[model samples]
Target: MAEQPKGRLVDVELDDTIGRATPDVEHERNVAIFDLIEENVFNPAGAPENGRFKLKLSLVDKRLVFDIRNEADEPLVTHILSLTPFRKVIKDYFMICDSYYEAIRSATPQQIEAIDMGRRGIHNDGSTTLMERLKGKIDVDLDTARRLFTLICVLQWRN
Candidate 1:
């Protein structure tokens, strides 16, 4: 059987221009980064060879950019994606997250759980959309995509 192509992220950076995110947003960003570094699949299409990579994510001119490089710090590939497809999903995710957070403070357990379920659903939608948009550019599993989507939403927080 042919071996599956796999790549891990050695380093991840989010651009400074993303601005000061809320405490909750920062926590989510940190958690996503940590989880992604711990385990991920980041095989960029047309890479020179199979190996771990470094990633710098940023928004430029309303486009989401993936700046990928090798462990040696050599540039590998860059993929730019339109933010249009993500607008609604990201907005919905934020709304649901806000509701979830607020619910935790006052809502009943069942209410909080319900809001959390909606949050997860929107998150999943964003993750699936991310994977589709990255098609032919990079390959990442659903979990990785979900974490990456969280980071993307952080970037969109101030934009």
Candidate 2:
């Protein structure tokens, strides 16, 4: 006998029903994460508080998931370089901040002044732009300056 076409062999009536199709329990598990970043190297008004920038890292079913929330009003291009710390959970967020600024904000006299004032007249015994101090001819953008300031602050805070 010729092979019959493979069809539903036992076709009676299979009720393909899924339980809990309409459930409120799913909504209860939903959560919203808020992240905040402040770039306030010039003044304290824009400094971000601890835990303001939230990054969520979780593993689900053998897959890694990352949730990053930045609650900043202005985006990266407008700000160029925002001196925000990064969490391992969120990839490329802070790196973008660093690169975007370094590519755009070159050393300016105003930034030189601000850094000098912030550092308490500690630039080459006078007013020397960040680029001038490096002696490497690298573009000293606002991000680099802010990073130096942050590192200094961290060191001092540790002391």
Candidate 3:
């Protein structure tokens, strides 16, 4: 088996224009960020070997920007991806997340489980798409991709 890349996110910053987000969204962001920092694989294409990385995520001119840096705050790779490809999946994920959250309030256990399954499915799809988009720009494992996808979803949330 190939050796897994060993890198983690030391810090993360999100540039969001949507003001404050919902409690659920904020919680999701916090969990994702915490989990991401605790464990992750981040290898910027063409960058020299580094122990940990810092990432600044932002949406500029409808493009998703990944401003990555090394531990010493030195510049690394900056990947800019089009948001068009992620539109449909993100929309679907948000819809399913809404259903899952609402199900927790009034639905039976079975119903909540079913909705949660759907939510996970959508989340997986979004993560896969994210990996594909970052294929040549950055390398990340599926778990890292999923957590980053959650943060990206939070960025799209509006007040």
Alpha-carbon TM-score of each model against the true structure: 0.96, 0.19, 0.94
Best by TM-score: 1
Q: For residues 42-115, could you state the per-residue lDDT of candidate 3 as single tens digits?
A: 88877765568999988888888899999899888788999898999999998999898999999999999999
Better of 1 and 3 by lDDT: 1
When sorted by lDDT, best at the front, the candidate numbers are 1, 3, 2
* TM-score of model 3 (CA atoms): 0.94
Give candidate 1's error at residue 70 in angstroms.
0.6
Q: Candidate 3 overall Cα lDDT vs. reference?
A: 0.88
Better of 2 and 3 by TM-score: 3
The models' CA-based lDDT, in order, is: 0.91, 0.27, 0.88
The candidate that wins on lDDT is 1
Candidate 3 regions with alpha-carbon error over 4 angstroms: 1-4
List, in order, the clash count of every candidate structure. 0, 0, 0
**In candidate 2, how many clashes are counted?**
0
Q: In model 2, what is the error at residue 69, expressed in angstroms? A: 30
lDDT of 2 by residue, 1-159 (tens): 974222110111111121221222112112101001123111111223221222233333322222323334222111111112222212232233234345446757676555445344332221133323333322233443433333222222222
Question: Global lDDT for candidate 1?
Answer: 0.91
**Model 2 weakest lDDT span, ten residues long:** 7-16
